[model samples]
Target: MSDSSQLPYRPCAGVMLVNQAGKVFVGQRIDSTLDAWQMPQGGIDDGEDAETAALREIGEETGIDPSLVRIVARARHELFYDLPSDLIGKVWKGRYRGQRQHWFLARFTGTDDDVKIDTDHPEFRAWKWAEPSELPAMIVPFKRKLYEDVIAEFAPWLESIA
Candidate 1:
């Protein structure tokens, strides 16, 4: 990840998918990839809206239809991490510079069987549900604060869901 502070904030959206068991969905990045587990997120495309991007990212990453999920909250956070030196060249192909993510919370209403890893884009290799507090250790350090904001905002809902 690029140093988020150095890069500047770009508009983005993330989705936290929580199940009835109180476990939130997390995806293990592809091997030697970003080297972190994360909720679904992506940059907002020009002419595309934030909610649209959030729904799109969730579907692309987890194969879950946005319609099957309910939006519980929308949280905003700015994160800065050094761009992995190797990927400095392949940035999002535009003027993004860095990611300014708007995170969303959702609960899965559909069966889990539909989730699959896409070999072409290959964002995540493995996935599992875990307690929200367990996330910081598994996420990229630069992005941990965003998860913190998310968890803090959702802690009460998490209890309610439980």
Candidate 2:
């Protein structure tokens, strides 16, 4: 696949939340028949800020409130994948190409019991704590390298956050 730098890519953010136990949160998608799993993420909305989008996406996907998480670090990753002409969102219409995601690392201040897995539009059915290094395989192939890159850049901060 071509890098988003080579293709039109929309900016996005994926948030990784960790607990005191040193485990990172991984969400198992509920709707996908294939049962894909990934961190909470979403496209940046105009008039809305990136950090706000990250926090909003985390709450929307995991049902955890934004107040419960503390921002640690952020890393940018870009991937180029074809979005069929008809599938691009209105923001990317006319010349839509692909997406570029900037992922953030956060540490949850609340306990495990505070996590709420069900939401009005849940993207996750189940969530569990996993090692940060093992997260790449759980994401989509086109996003795997980006995930790795984000984790690598924030490994030290993640360790301390845990």
Candidate 3:
């Protein structure tokens, strides 16, 4: 196998969507058997900027309209996480070692009724609002540190809402 270090990190965007209650959105991945939950995130398409990709991903995954969310703050810098060795060749066609993600914090202006996880191509089987501090523990092991960094980067904004 080619060295994972030699592989490129996929460019992606992530969202930390928090409601008025300061709880963040998390979803159980439809494709994962593990009890892993994650915020809305996906690859950045050609010519699309990170912030735009973040919004688009949120709409695609959660069926939340862009108008229903207010962009709060973006992470100071991009964060990265590596895929576990066993998953390296099984995901993303083996082209990427993991993801380098630009994350955004957005406030959900609509109620829970606004969230619909049954999009045409749904990524999540279930979704919920979670406490910010619980983020790292809820995600896949490989992504725990990345979630921690996201929570840290948005700490001030998260605290202000709480």
**Which regions of candidate 1 fall more than 4 Å away from where they truly are?**
1-7, 31-35, 76-90, 93-97
- Candidate 2 minimal-lDDT segment of 10 residues: 77-86
lDDT winner among the candidates?
A: 3
- Steric clashes per prediction: 12, 0, 0
Q: List the residue pairs that clash in candidate 3.
A: none
Q: What tens-digit string does per-residue lDDT give for candidate 3 at 9-92?
A: 999999999998999999999998999999999999999999999999999999999999888898989999999999998999
lDDT of candidate 1 at residue 114, scale 0 to 100: 61
Q: What does the lDDT read for residue 99 in candidate 3?
A: 99
What lDDT does candidate 2 reach at residue 75? 69
TM-score to true structure, per model: 0.81, 0.81, 0.98
| Cα lDDT of model 1 by residue, 115-141, tens digit | 776744878989888898998888987
Model 2, global lDDT: 0.76
Q: Which of 1 and 2 is the better model by lDDT? A: 2
lDDT of each: 0.75, 0.76, 0.95
lDDT, model 1: 0.75
